[model samples]
Target chain A: MIGNPQSVAPEPSFRDFSKLCVHTITTKPWSVEEAAEHFAMSGIGGITVWRDALANRNIYQIGQLLRDHNLSIVSLCRGGFFPNLEAAGRQAAIDDNRRAIDEAAELGAPHVVLVCGAVPGQPLTESRKQIRDGIAALMPHAEASGVRLAIEPLHPMYADNRSAINTLGQANDMAEELNSPFVGVAVDVYHLWWDPDLEKEIARCGKNGHLYAFHICDWKTPTLDLLNDRGLMGEGCINVRQIRSWVEAAGFNGFNEVEIFSNRYWAEDQAEFLEKIKHGYLYHS
Target chain B: MIGNPQSVAPEPSFRDFSKLCVHTITTKPWSVEEAAEHFAMSGIGGITVWRDALANRNIYQIGQLLRDHNLSIVSLCRGGFFPNLEAAGRQAAIDDNRRAIDEAAELGAPHVVLVCGAVPGQPLTESRKQIRDGIAALMPHAEASGVRLAIEPLHPMYADNRSAINTLGQANDMAEELNSPFVGVAVDVYHLWWDPDLEKEIARCGKNGHLYAFHICDWKTPTLDLLNDRGLMGEGCINVRQIRSWVEAAGFNGFNEVEIFSNRYWAEDQAEFLEKIKHGYLYHS
Candidate 1:
């Protein structure tokens, strides 16, 4: 009752690479092609492509390149910055999201992760409304393209300008209100590990059949940068394995996407970092 | 309903400094005597004494000095760091908290704010239990000394080691569970502003008569340092005045305590910083 607040399932054994996925941004030093080659060589199971990694590239060709390496295409990294002061700006964000969905569909990716947006000076309530409206506007495009939208709740630290959806409960509220098979929530450990309502909310989302994607990372104690500075699994305090157990118990049988944005790790030899990720995935996660 | 999720009260006019309180640590460069002289000269209404500011000084004399300046001695800055992995360490924390309470009594402050502690890797649930038990253990002495304890829920960013209590609702639950007249919750906008449930929780704590203190500060956008990069009111996106309105509506007519820990502000001239604080207090807050 004190520590294990609920019946948290024990960690699943990682005997193979079937469930391991890596975000392209996690290996910043490597180009998409390089990441694909290295990831395939490392026996990485999947790859979540960031938009930046696909710049100036042919979406279909890149998709083929990844598939040729036997890397499963997970969700696209992001597509949401919906809150804007001006009407035109909001429209621009929505239009950009449509493009992201189109790209994901072309790339053979099943879903696009949405980092629901916030404006710094705008009231969070207004921002929340805008995020909901933005997502609703995209539902048609998403469904038509056969691409799902996963609402990824950011940490409270990012509530200012990153995302008004700072809790899984808030994300669930929005997703349920929207009510689309094409709309669901992404569970990211880095953003949600500290939430006290995590287990209960995970169960709620799972029961509602809204859990779509699961992202994994750790939170360093003296997190040097708000944007970067995430720890690799087993390098920080987050019980990634425990959270994974909860995610699995919630009926999410998805890739454990290692979506780190650490300047420290990115500065390292990326191949070595990939090796560490494998070790962490096998042992820590 | 989109922007103002509930009926948030409008900002109260800051016609005077009668309700303004400044924490000593806010002016980190100043000695307690220096802070007292400057604060009184500026017509600041109250002072919350941080423990470090009273080091190796006569507590009774400092109390007399503060009173001599016609300043209201607000609650002492802190007391609790209750959670510890070792029994002896936990006892040491309790003993230190007792000393903090005694210091508050000597300084003529009403309550000692509790920054309930956490071990870096300790499960927050376990740390939470330790925090509850620790506070419950200190109830007798707290009652005997006629000193109150305010459980200050820190930001989730500090959930790693600073404090396990990261939400005002959690603090309210603990205060209600403890069922002590000597124990209550401190609502700090810097910590609780991002919470979607804040307005409801504030109202809940107020209805239960568990609201003890209110601290004010801004949360910067690019929060460079987790501990020392807090923004001054109006300099960031927090909408401090609006939050102040909510607290006032919740029946909290306590001092609007300015508790900023900013490396940017601290590096400036302390006197000029005090002027800025006054300006921020009147116009922004």
Candidate 2:
């Protein structure tokens, strides 16, 4: 009876997701130690820190917090913003991304997530080609660092100036083009829920060994702002459980990393925010 | 050499776009004749009127407006809202949709566009089934009306409340199941641009003879509002020209309906709104 795949009941919530990774932005103003302490207390398995968050705290300090709190660095907060106007500018972006790869390696992180940049000063397609070239240039360094480069296809709304790689298919194509063991994509539900071919594309990526990471978040109804109106899991319209099922079906066994950019979340106390996330993980997700 | 397909370059300026079709909502408070009059003065090829816009003005009046303004109705505003809890409720949707079809035919519209309803207060997949059933029910009536029912797959955000058929692929699947000449999908750039398999889906629609209408509009970057904040074609970020090229390639020869739901545009004078659409028609397309 359990083998009935067409069961229409609401999916069971994962209450004891001890391996949940709290994104740095989730505890925006919290110090690294504070975040680590909160993560440790929550029984959460890991933390995802952004480059900006680590700017004030040295790597040793950040590393020590992770070690002391027993927090695994699920993935680093990204490196790719490749497109640029001039060849030198483009080269500059490549060099910077190479450093990000190195930083991810130093942090003992599994992947240096890439937000492949959008068209610099021209059209989208041309910028996409440049993004491919940027990744192709940085792939060897990423390989050398033993750090996977996870390309994130930002929403199409960000296609002009944020990230031109706006679809998993497009990202998978680029990853295959680069032909690198280390370069893949970070499949974020917030960015990808609208994709009609997501399941098929995820399967394709799985076939190519390119689906590196998965980020989970709900898309709120009457989305107030495109960038920050993200809903907590199960609060908004997205079928997060359905998406999770698809991911699991596609052979992806990874962290259901929460990455919210909601203004409402940031204003709350860090502990409250962390607690809400933990609660959201409990009954909502 | 000119026999070769003209790749969509930047279109001419809006002032030069003597050819256009004013989608009625651009001027919210105006009558269909008034909107048609506006279209005529601006040298528009057609005007798409909402059901409300047609309510007070009888079909005879609408037909007279069509003749007086030399205006063509590309398609009617809408018809389908299929899924519902009760059988009668579902039947109500179909009956109303059939009424819309009759209205479209009376007003000489080529298609009675269907915005298939979402979960009749249930799961997305169930709503999808309901949508399929509703379409099957309406097919005979739609065929009798001689008005094509174009199923418009809205953006995925509306999957819970508005329409569960949120992808062109899903729409195509339903269209195939119906296997009738009366039902298909409308291709709106705003709803479909984020789609990874857009080109493939467009091609599929073309092959299946289901590409009923093409809607052109930009997706605002910060998209201030969800249902509204649509960009004037060139002013916002969507690569309209590239998409138009794909639509054309797919053999969809029809009115390129400009459907902008921007609060900013709505605030502008109606003539200038039409003129702005003309600009959109011409440049940054």
Candidate 3:
């Protein structure tokens, strides 16, 4: 159980898009309206909206538009970049997070994913402290909005500027320290696949009822760009099926969210890419 | 101490290149012969020769030439790519490793660093098992040659094709499991700097006498190329000096080997680059 979790659970079959969810950023070329139309047309179950996608649009109307298409608002793309050097900056981040929570509440989304930032030269230890303080400050606002906060630990390659919390273990520790029902963890396959302790940590967070969201994508072998160049599920080496089994075993009956950021795929017709995602979902994931 | 090891150790000042070593791959433009002469002229203390740099060279004579230049032959650059899909491929890798051990012994190097390879489609657990078996197979030969095998954990970005061992904890675990004096771990800042468990694992390996080598380099803020694009010391966000303090505090009295693979630096005058390495070694490292 400790070392070989994959062996204990047989591979689960995925027949349709009932549990499939696509992030707005995955098909970056599409407008939110277009994405909602296409996702609903393709029978995709849900959509995670990036903050940018909601720009210049009436958020309430946009939520209505998505619901009109029968799309469940999975979660807001991001809200955390909480670590900052100055008190003003930290306060600004808290304010922004509060707004994100408000937006999520209005959008009928359940949670806001936290990228939990790191400053370039700031010690990760200090950045982590700032992240904790920022999250604590936002808890009251989040509770009032009836929105949960999902702390998404980024890849270690992004540790310099993207996140101080680079492991699920760290995210779990922070969530437990805060001891809030409004705070939890997001499990992203692309970021956490390489970790040896992933299974144990997944179980740990799940058992504590802190597993809020699950995101899926593949790690391309020759990842050309650090921030982009993510592969579709079947294109890379990650055993997504095995990891999905771990998540399902942990009592996460949520969407198998497809969250990819790829310049190559974005340049193509997103409708075609959506078909590929479904194919990958059925056979590879 | 459990979380912030850097705050516990004071930064040590480096006055000279007496403990500085450079890997041959750092100056890829130079031949081993050219690297030896230039490194000696620059008063660099040691050189770790990459296997590619040894092409068609007389190993014994190369060792003699390095000694003549008053350069300590540090551990050979690499010897492991143990994980393979086929038994024949695995056997072939072991044979190559044995040959690498022979070359290291002939080159008067004390150890050979292992990259511990992974196949794109292989599960990391299976690859790790193959790595352990491959290393175990080489232990007797390594001991006979009075040469050690230092398992160098690569960055997790390389988990697809480069190396399955991506954390110092994993490397330390493998080395201890192999349970041979000829088996040990190499600490590289570029690969392990982002790990939260780094300090504890460094102390663990050092206490067990399994910490065999220490490599130094910086991770660029915007790492352009996955294979190359390494930064000079002080060029990126990694706390190279702080990590060095931890390595030293863990009772490692080995050379601070500068190992960079940057396409940008290789395009520069290597003699000038050597001067920068000396400066970075003194002030940044």
Candidate 4:
């Protein structure tokens, strides 16, 4: 027998969607206006909007629409790339992230997911220290805005050029050290599912109330490209239900926000893209 | 002053190699024969042999040469790709690895490095369990040959289709569970240099005396190919000296083998490659 009560339900019903926020990136086919309409149509609990898509509309305009649609922004696109040898460069990154946090707050985002940068012109160890301090510095502004800073630990492959924080445990450590409920971790399945300490760390994050946002995407085995080659849920090799169970077991009741950055999927029609997202949701559920 | 007694020496002489044996892999440019001679010439300590260059020279020949050159074979190129879905395929891999273990014993290798294979058609969590069990089953034969099994946890990038064991902590956990001094881990700087829990894990391994082998290679930014693209010691960003120091500090007096699987270096003249190996010894001393 399957573990989850939801999984035991026979025949996928789109009804009772009182708890499911589908991410906009999953339906990259839809424009910002179209996606907001789609989320309303699907009766999803909420939605996540990307900065690029939001750029088509004014931030204030998008904020107004979400209010009208009764949609909740689980998280804003991102904010932290704070590792550079140059002090000026590092400051600029922090400033940019602060702006992002403000934007997230403006959009009524509960948390601003931070892919806390990489080893910029230095050893990874030193850069990691810089990233830790960077998050600490950003916590005050985030707390004041009522926007929690969710440190999203990217996959270890991105440890060099992307985010040095590669494990949930490491992210939790930073959150615990900050000792602010305002600071926690964004548990992205694509990034953290492979972690052997995942079960232990997720529990720790849950106990600490450090589990901020839950992002979903599958890891394609032949992953041709590092950055953009993400898979649709259940299409690749990830045990999504298993990880979803872990997150849910850890007291997480957030949306399994579908976020795929695939060129193959991106090249498809917007309607087809939305169709695929719906398919992923229905099939996985 | 640094923690070690002679830690202040300029490069080579000041290096605290009390608990480290140096192993040479010619990411620099040397062939297998050339590396064997260099291991003898450098007076550095042990080595781990790759399968490619050794393919031309049979396993028996490899053992004889290691004996002739008076080099300690810290480990054999690797043996675990147990996640293949097909039973015949899985058995084939096991058979090959068994041969690898025998070769390790023939060369007096203290350990056989294992790149625990990846998920075939199942979830990584399941395959990971299979990998651990695979090692456990193979342990009896390994014990008979007097060869320790060193689980080399690959980076998370290789979780699918490569090696499921993607962290030092994971490898240590397997070693601890097996409760055999014969089964342990190989800490390669290229793969594990970015681990945030690395210091604690290294100490843990040291105390367990499970630190079987230490491999060295730099991580290049914009790493073109995941498999073949590795940096030469001092040429790339990783602080090799710092990692070397950490390994030594951890109670391991084993070889710091340089295993660079770079296509660029492989094409270079063997003498030039040998010089760079010597240069790395002195430069990254």
| Leading candidate by DockQ | 1
Native contact recovery (fnat) for each candidate is 0.54, 0.26, 0.48, 0.46
Error of 2 at B188 (Å): 1.8
Candidate 3, A1-285: lDDT as tens digits: 243432332245425687889999999899999999999999899999999999999999999999999998999989999988899999999999999999999999999999999987688999999999999999999998899999999988888899999999999999999999999999999999989999999999999999999999888888898888999887888989889999999999999999998889999999999999987777677
Colliding pairs, model 2 = B11-B282, B12-B282, B14-B278, B14-B279, B241-B285
Ranking of all predicted structures according to lDDT, beginning with the best and ending with the worst: 3, 1, 2, 4
TM-score of each: 0.95, 0.88, 0.95, 0.86
Cα lDDT tens digits, model 2, B1-285, are 233122343434434333356688867756777787777877788777788887766886687778688887788988878878788889888888878888888888878888887652266667888888888887787788788888899976676578877778888988888899888889888887766678899999898899988888887666677687788887665677778888789888777788877788788787877777876777655
Q: Write the per-residue lDDT of candidate 2 for residues A172-264, one digit (tens) a residue.
A: 888888888998888888887756678899888887888888887777766677678787876776666677778878888878798999888
DockQ of 3: 0.61
Displacement of the residue A103 alpha carbon in candidate 1, Å: 0.4
Measured with C-alpha atoms, the lDDT of residue B216 in candidate 4 is 79
Q: Is the docking of candidate 2 incorrect, acceptable, medium or high quality?
A: acceptable
Which scores higher on lDDT, 1 or 4?
Answer: 1
Model with the higher DockQ, candidate 1 or 2: 1
TM-score of 4: 0.86
Q: Tens-digit lDDT track for model 4 on A198-274?
A: 88999899888889788877888788887788987767777777778888999998877878888898888866666
TM-score, chain A, candidate 4? 0.92
The C-alpha stretches of model 4 lying farther than 4 A from their native spots are: A1-31, A37-45, A68-70, A121-129, B1-47, B52-58, B69-72, B84-93, B121-125, B267-274
Alpha-carbon error at B84 in model 1, in Å? Answer: 1.2
Overall lDDT per candidate, in order of appearance:
0.91, 0.78, 0.91, 0.77
Candidate 1 per-residue lDDT, tens place, B75-190, comes to 89888888888999999999999999999999999999999988887899999999999999999999999999999999898899899999998999999999999999999999
Chain B TM-score (model 1 vs. true structure): 0.94
